[model samples]
Target: MTAGERTGEKKDQCQGTGDINFKDRIASSPCVFTIGVAGDSGSGKTTFTQSIRDIFGEDLVTTITLDDYHLYDREERKVRQITPLHPEANRLDQLEHDLVELKEGHTIEKPVYNHATGRFDPPIRFSPGKILILEGLHTLFTPTLREHLDFTLFVEPDPEVKIEWKIRRDINKRGYTREQVMAELGPREEDYQRFIAPQQQYADVVVRVRFSKYGRERGTQDKVYQVSLSQNKITQSIEDVDLSIDLFSLLSLSDRNFLIEFSHEQRNTERSGELIFDGELSARMVERLEQSIEDQTQVRPISVFHNRGHVTATEVVQLILAWRIIHQRVFLERCHHLDQIQG
Candidate 1:
């Protein structure tokens, strides 16, 4: 199967319903739940965000790409001999300001970064939705920006996988030659290590993708992915839904060879729980678990995802992340209420 097949294609379906108390609370108050997704270019950050989008329909979710904050266009970066991965190449200050504005349910004129031309387009008046997702290189890089985000995620793909994804994307989507893509890697990696990698420490969750060891032993390494989601221990206190996987049920019903590993570990000097999943997964099992999630959260299934009828390790990660986001929304609401009472 192709990569698209693994992740599943989008299906046209109606939205799902959930406990409307939180939704109504937000609608009345007009607060935005901000999420920050940080990753190197082509690290599958877009794909990761799409999973969250699937959980909440388009009407409630809005996305902003951080590339729009680039301080210099492609030619300018080349002239300056600076990589876009460097903090100086991006207007992080403007990003912090925009994030604050969005969090306060205010509209802002946002810039647009055109990948095809490696330049920016005219600014557009952008409005904040109920849930605003800010994704880019330095999203979680600074303390000020992190303060604005309700939840933060970082995506780190293995070096080889990142190179493969980047080369394919820059050449196919961004109008770059093979030689140009290869030549830029040296400086980009240097800047990435210095500026981007350290931001992982601030993330509430970190996703690392690499070649599947099981697939490697079976000589299918290129096609299978091993994805590890490392979640910060601090976020555990607010978990409102049960996320335990029924391993017994999964093992009995699934025919595919797979590996699942769970561990408590320290990532960047922070306590975190990491779960790794690889190989083909059981679709029915995942769907059942999703239903359980909705049941506990007291939300009706969003028809878009409920009707998709396909499952992979990717979808599982998305479901968990979506659940976290929903509860984070609730948690924020409670905090707001508490502050009002105290005041």
Candidate 2:
């Protein structure tokens, strides 16, 4: 039984970390929305979810990286001749326990993985937020860990794109030479295929990103993307959310060079729908779509696509994916309400 059932009092929705009254109420109960994001490193997982963070703000969203659960430090892994992508290299069992504790609204001293130093730093206390994001290579690798995720996202970038992104990041930020980064790819990709790629089949939403022809012609391929969003059909309808695209408005943007396609198919034996977007869309074009979603669902402005002269396909997909997550949140909320009434 839930704390709410035992107390027999309806739990108020948490406003954020700053709301004292809500915090007090939550202290007596556990209410959290957990989202698991899985992807190979440098696959744009963080870039893709920027809109969700914009909507909920950091105060209400707590993100935990699975890298911290690494069983071996960088040098140790080198000695062991194993990549971080290997399943045996992480503390998966402890990750599961920590997730469960966070779900119950308990604080945990989460370990820190220093990316720059390639070592485990001192652990820090982590408190649950209204929304919890568990992002890493193995979030969906184990069934028990998957069970605690309210929503799952998988990012699959084109192989070339992944390599380019990783090389840039590791070289510029992680202090790796281009040659060293190139050498690591052979073994890393092998490990990624064996241990990480399979998690894509389990995600409710899979985002595939590739270079856009428009960007290639303009020599801005790094700044632009062609993103395809495959959404597993909604599990069940929720009254509070609706997924609708305004075709009329979408078609009216004649000045923008863009492409949008919708199709239905079976992915991994599950029915799913895919929307592909390519080209340089004007900010107004994206706003019209966002407004359409808000008008239909009466949801507040989601604003993942920042107002600019042109919007990239990545930003457009982020808006749509964020909308789906909003729907998931509402559905989970409704289920919680039903449990309260039954109790």
The per-candidate count of clashes, in order, stands at: 4, 0
TM-score per candidate: 0.85, 0.85
The C-alpha local distance difference test score for the whole of candidate 1 amounts to 0.74
1-343, model 1: which lDDT tens digit per residue? 2111211222112123345544445556677888889999889887777855775558778999999999999999999999989999999999989888898988999999999888899999999888899889999888889877877889999998899888888888888999999999998998999999988887777898877766543323334578889975532223234445557756567566667789999877656789987765655446665665565445556332554433556556767777666655655565556557778
Candidate 1 backbone overlaps, count: 4
Per-residue error for 280 in candidate 1, Å, reads 2.0
Displacement of residue 270 (Cα, Å) in model 1 is: 3.6
RMSD of each: 8.0, 6.0
